[model samples]
Target: MTTGMEELAARMRDFAQAREWEQFHTPKNLAMALAGEVGELIGEFQWLTPAESSSLDEETFDRVRSELADVTAYLVRLADLLGVDLIEATKAKLEENERRYDANLYRGSARKAPH
Candidate 1:
């Protein structure tokens, strides 16, 4: 069956098509731009409280949205390039999480390493 991941990817592709940007989305270029976006995200929180980070002004909001779009675009492109079934991957991760963080140990406990 078709999945949410597939639909989101198709929508992303359609967005690129509408913008005529597919020509510029080479994997290497996208990866480089993705790092830039991540840096921008980190820049927002540098030496700031969670409250301060949450109270971003309009320019910061726009920067965050643009950078988040970059991250999502890069991730979707990578997932597509790798032929990964992301829904399946997500499910697998959840299953692994359940095994690793069993209720007896991690439920309502302090956030510590699994080991």
Candidate 2:
């Protein structure tokens, strides 16, 4: 069954609270942790060529998956701690992006539109 953000956030909160990790779960610390996890996720592709990166072996894929989960967890934790609803924030950002990157103008283009 699929779990909602509230459930996930609650789980993270319980996990942190149980370990008395709230002291370390400040926005600044959580953001830093998220960044570090993202770095680790990127490191999984560090030596691979573009094609190789796209087709990872099982072991490599597993490592990347774990790192990705870490990144997501930390990001959710940070958003929760800051009282931000990530789902709403993401939807709002996508709406903003639609205005900035109109499909008709930006379609199939690699260049970013100047704000």
Candidate 3:
């Protein structure tokens, strides 16, 4: 079964191709937009604590989701345009993170990695 997100991603790709926007969707530009959308997403919880943010009404939560979806949409578009394997990229990054946060040193710890 085709999930909704996958369908949406396909539609977004088709739309981009129809508009010839691929030329403008460079990695740098998409990355900047992703950051901006993330900032907007974070702004929604600017001063809210984990509890407060988590306790928000569904409507507020939906706003956060909307921002997150925007970020994800652009990232998906970039990956499609560049032929990037997002699944592979994500796994590679997580493996890098696991190596950096070695179990012996970071087991159950949440400290930032050394600078």
Native-to-model Cα distance after best TM-score fit, residue 23 in candidate 3, in Å: 3.2
Tens-digit lDDT string for candidate 2 (11-104): 9999999999999999999999999999999999999999999999999999999998899899888888889989899999999998988889
C-alpha-based local distance difference test score of model 1: 0.78
Ranking by TM-score: 2, 3, 1
Q: Of the candidates shown, which would achieve the greatest lDDT relative to the real structure?
A: 2
By lDDT: ranked, best first:
2, 3, 1
In the range 1-115, model 3's lDDT, one tens digit per residue, is 7666567669887887899987778888988888999999999998999899879889889998899899989888777667786877999999988888887887766565544
TM-score of every model versus the real structure = 0.65, 0.90, 0.78
Query: Model 3 shows how many backbone clashes?
Result: 0
lDDT for each of the candidates?
A: 0.78, 0.90, 0.83
Q: What tens digits encode model 1's per-residue C-alpha lDDT throughout 25-103?
A: 7777777777877887888678778897889889888988887877876777767756777678999998998898877
lDDT of 2: 0.90
Candidate 2 — which residues are off by over 4 angstroms?
1-3, 113-115
Preferred candidate (lDDT higher): 1 or 3: 3
Q: How far is candidate 2 from the true structure (C-alpha RMSD, Å)?
A: 2.2
